[model samples]
Target: MFKRIITLVILVPVAIVLILLSVANRQTVTLAFNPFEPSDPVLSQSAPLFVFLFAALMLGMIIGSLATWFNQGKHRSRARNKAQEAVKWHSEADRQKAKATELARSSTLPPPAESAPRG
Candidate 1:
């Protein structure tokens, strides 16, 4: 809940700013794939400046995420190893508990039965 509030606080203004920026820069710009041919009809696209900005932002995010994931690979591996060990330990503990319970049951003697004769 606190995270949601903080996210809203941070994202709301950023969203508004992006919206305003896109609105202000609504003019279409031609992007040519071939730098040598500025007027290349086949290799050029006309799009708003915001489209390029947003595209760059998305691309950066994707690259950063991939880099972060790769950087944390060792940590993830360690966590997975620890989790497997923990599961093994838990199963061992359960087996020991079952053995202890069985031992306790076998070690204890049964109560003596009393038979009364009625007249």
Candidate 2:
């Protein structure tokens, strides 16, 4: 519930701002890829200013996410190694426990007799 409220609080304002920005910047703008010709570009496309803004924002986010993931590669590898070590240790403990149980069952020692009550 708390998470949901926080998400709503953060997202609601951002959503409102983005909506307002898109509405305010609805004018068409041409994006030219050709640097050689300024007058007429061979590679160019026209789109709303907000569309480019959103596209750049999304691209930046994806690039950032990839960079973070790459940077944490060593940490992720360490975690995987630790998890495998834990599994190995757990299996070893189980094996030792089973061996102890088997030894106890095979023992020939008699059970202790109860002491008599004093009169």
Top model number, lDDT = 1
Backbone clash total for model 1 is: 0
Badly placed stretches (over 4 Å) of model 1 are: 109-119
Q: What does the lDDT come to for candidate 1?
A: 0.96
lDDT of 2 by residue, 7-99 (tens): 999999999999999999999999887788654656887899999999999999999999999999999999999999999999999999999
Give me the runs in candidate 2 sitting further than 4 Å from their true place: 110-119
**lDDT agreement with native, every candidate:** 0.96, 0.94
What are the per-residue Cα lDDT tens digits for candidate 1 across 1-119? Answer: 99999999999999999999899999999888999998999999899999998998999999999999999999999999999999999999999999999999999988877778777
The TM-score measured for candidate 2 stands at 0.85
Per-residue lDDT value at 116 in model 2 = 100
